[model samples]
Target: MLFRVITLFDEKKNKIPATIVHGATIEIIWTSIPALILLIVAIPSFALLYSMDEVIDPIITLKVIGSQWYWSYEYSDNLEFSDEPLIFDSYMVQEDDLAIGQFRLLEVDNRVVVPTNSHIRVLITASDVLHSWAIPSLGIKLDACPGRLNQTSMFIKREGVFYGQCSEICGVNHGFMPIVVEAVSLEDYLTWLKNKINFDFNI
Candidate 1:
């Protein structure tokens, strides 16, 4: 879908001869074609949304906190700790440790793990400044305000790692904040969650 939209932009930029034979006709054609295409696409989008609304169960819930230099995530629906809830901080990886096919400045140390085919709701808010949370594969981007909460939803269709970054400028470290999401099987997610919950830090 992003490909189509981006291609459309390219087409618009490179379209037609500058010699205007009929301005009125060109306006009508340009306006009507995009509207017609939108109508064609809106039908399926609406239907898919309505179908998802009928799901019977809530799969998972996560809370995200954007800070000056890092991001923190918590699984509110899955309890991992009694006194302290299960949470972790995600930091961007340095250039030397980055791998191929991963976008530099957009890879994190710890990526959030969720089960595939599960409805996941993310609640985003900033701790001290404004930021944005976005994932291109899922087509979701929401603002993270200091005193306000933003919510967005996405269901991972496949199991893999996806990357994103802070879309809004906050401070000196704004470019260092990264978001990584890993969609895995339910069993694998449970195993990872257990490890996260029981991690020892008493070095």
Candidate 2:
């Protein structure tokens, strides 16, 4: 299309016509075509941008803190940790300790477990240096800036394990920072929460 529109002198025509070059019709056709194409594309792009920025009432909010080479997670829905811990750090699984089918640098000690078919908000921040909490399968990559919070949301449709890593070059052990998120059913998630948190919810 570019060649046809740009190259006025084709195989049949050797020299370009002066009227065709200076005509208003040709200029309008060339200019309006790109403008029309851009208008056609801008509709859906703006819709997606607005939808991503939409803030819905989330059932659970999880806080993620990025460290030098690891991540810390806190379940914001529960503050029942007086002595028993409700927050934990996730460290990457070493190569030797990896199971047969587990990934080499993708697995972590504690996975961020969430319920499927639910709206979950994640607040990401960094403690030591700048980091990025990214999950490829979920299409989420939010920066973990120190002393600042970045928010993102996700709705897992099915039960699966999503993996990610620190995309930013923070320090020497940046390659070791891996993240794992496991989505389960509502009943299973509630059961896991009960067992993990040991707090009875009046749901």
User: Which numbered prediction scores highest in TM-score against the true structure?
Assistant: 2
| 161: Cα error in model 1, Å | 0.9
lDDT of 1 by residue, 1-203 (tens): 99986876585686872565778988999999999999999999999987754534558888999999899998876553345678889999999999987788888888999999888878899999889998887797899999998777778989998888899999888889989999999888877876877753222
Candidate 2 wrong stretches, greater than 4 Å: 1-51, 80-85, 200-203
Error of 1 at 6 (Å): 42
lDDT of 1: 0.84
Tell me the tens digit of each residue's lDDT in model 2 across 115-193.
Answer: 9999999999999899999999999999999999888999999999999999999999999999999999988887778
Q: Which pairs clash in the backbone of model 1?
A: none
After superposition, which runs of candidate 1 have C-alpha atoms over 4 Å from their true positions? 1-56, 80-83, 99-103, 199-203
Instruction: Output the worst ten-in-a-row residue range by lDDT, candidate 2.
Output: 76-85
TM-score of every model? 0.67, 0.73
